[model samples]
Target: MTEQVMAAIDGSQFSEGVCDYAAWASRALDAPLTFLHVVDNHPQTAEADLSGNIGLGSREHLLEELAHLDEQRAKVAQEQGRLMLKAASERAVEAGVVEPRTRQRNGTLVETLSELEDETRLVVLGKRGETAHQDSGHLGSNLERVVRSLHRPILMVPATFKRPEKVMIAFDGSKTTRRGVEMLAKSPLFDGIPVHVMIVGAETGDNRSQLDWALTTLHEAGHVAEGEIRAGEVEETLRAYKEQHGIDLVVMGAYGHSRIRHLLVGSTTTAVLRKADMPVLLLR
Candidate 1:
């Protein structure tokens, strides 16, 4: 069976852009695209006790009004979710995708995504949501939380991204890196594009063998890939590599070490995502 690419949609403009990107990628890989929307049904904040100033009957009426408003909001959210998925499915068909699926869940985004990860080959989400923080660049609260929590490949779609051409891969000797390499090797997402597989922080003398191994793996998988080794800070090296190669997209492993180590020392994945200017494809 063909792999499936899942995208989270909530009818926001940024989410719509994410749907478009997901459609493009699914078509490129000849995979199915699944659009997901989560209806937030969490309880609303407690109402202020205005009953002190009002009669008992009036207080009951006020509470009923509040409940009615909450119900209306929930209904609106569900309707919007359905509309977003329908529009995304239409776009996928217009883009020539063979089969597309839509799913709506009522729960936390993280839980819904975790449940779908087993069959999802990739997860695409918007950089910012309806309630994003103002200071963050590539990721806001929802995307950040999902990225940190999930152990799957995620493609964070920016609001202003056009079609991607040249692709850059941040390759290191990690299980996540291996998974990324295997996907790129077998998938058509980067088939006809120029791929630069870069290994940062490698010793100059030992770099040749590692590059050769990466190149051999790609070649054996029928991908025309080139490998290079660079020295310096991981994020800086990747930025310079992108500039030199005019990279349109950057793909890398999400986290390298254990969760405890990441929490203590900070993660290179987070650093790169915050600093990189181009679109990012993160593999976990």
Candidate 2:
């Protein structure tokens, strides 16, 4: 089956770059590009006021007002959604992808995408939403939440990133790492790009076999790849490897352990996303 690339847009300026990147990837992979904008039902603080009244009649009036306000917001959202999708489709055309499809959804962002994950070959989200404060590379909660919830590859495009060159794979021989390896091996996104598969953690006698497996998979895919098994903390090791190699993008698996474990000990994926200066492609 042909791959399907889904880009989650919010009519934000940052989403334009995400659409462009997804479009380029779609063309490169001969995949279909889908531009998606979720009309969030969650209201912003500016649209609602709670300080005016607290009586039952006042509450009923507030509900009525909120309902009206939601209708207006939905209208504006629909207009913007059309424009965003149109612009994204034009961009895909410029990138040589014809007949890109655009979709508008109304519901929880992560929940909706998760429902569509089966047909989606990859999910692309802007690192930060349109309302995010400038100068902050920190991703918004929704993006982060979606990453944690879904079991699909997520390609997060930074607000200002133009394109990527070298790709880095954070390999550790875990199930998640293997999934990422499988994705990179089959996906055209990393085609023709040098894949630096770095295996962090203390190298045991068994690690060599894992390295061999990763290398074999890439080689079978006709990709140029090299493996490195280093001893150190996962975050520090990957960060150092990125610096030394001038890596343009980092690919890894998202959350691995249970939420409780992750909350207490923090997963390597979280650490990498939070600290890595370059773009990250996370496989679930």
Candidate 3:
């Protein structure tokens, strides 16, 4: 019944990275690691609906063939998922995780994770899922939903795993973000890693105070932390700071704005997820 670091592996290009990062987090948190692979049920559901509408004769034969085809596809996908889970667990073992576990289920990724959320300490996923386009700017279709649904911290890793040496916090002084800073201050995930906290937009007194508070909080927790204020868009400023400092990971709070509002005006969280080349740890 111990809490575990649950990693979502979908046999995408990011699967390896997900395993690596999840392994790192498991070791850092001293928690058990579990790799989860969910085979989507959309195809089977659609095929079943179509099969019922077929009348008779040739159509009935077609329905039977289609049902058989769907069955075959589902079996193939399940076998593939099993293989992928085995590979992921092996990779985690190689990455210094001890006795990593894996689970394969028939459902959506979001639903599976939600069911296991109580036992999960952290969730790690690739920036893009298997169905996502190859374009670097494309966000995974399920990323936002997963983030919205899970209360636990989610680490969205890039296509490659790089041992993070420097970390950046996109601070905005909101309650959620403050909680994120608190988590970083107390969590051992970034124990020896130096952190740079940056604030975007005007350098007002309140912003400076908040930045100071963040630095103080981190410093109190023994982090080698520093703060800065920049003038520009949040995403751009954070990206620029990351590049300038060679940050391998970016940590921040996300989804503060309503979903509809974010859709209309766009969101810094979405923008960063779309553009970041490094791993991003999101706190909801």
Q: Which is the leading candidate under lDDT?
A: 3
For all predicted structures, in order, the TM-scores are: 0.86, 0.87, 0.93
Instruction: For candidate 2, write residues 1-284 as lDDT tens digits.
Output: 46589988885656866887788778777779899888876734345467366777678877787789878988898898889888888878887898999989888778888888878888888777766655554656777788778877788776555567788888767788887888888877778888888888666877888888999999999989898999987888888888899888998877553345563124777777766565788876
**Model 3 CA lDDT for position 190:** 91
Give the lowest summed-lDDT range of ten residues in model 1. 257-266
Candidate 2 CA-lDDT value: 0.78
Cα lDDT tens digits for candidate 1, 17-134 = 7877898889887778999999877732435656568788688887888789879988998998898889889887887887799999998788899888788888888777765654
Q: On residues 71-145, what C-alpha lDDT tens digit does candidate 3 reach at each position?
A: 888899999999999999888888889999988889899899999999999999998888878899998878878
- The regions of model 1 sitting more than 4 angstroms off are 1-3, 43-59, 136-138, 257-260, 264-266
lDDT of 1 at 254: 72
Runs off by more than 4 Å, candidate 3: 43-56, 256-266
lDDT of each: 0.77, 0.78, 0.87
How many residue pairs of model 1 clash at the backbone?
0
lDDT for position 202 in model 3: 88
Q: How should the candidates be ordered by TM-score, best one leading?
A: 3, 2, 1
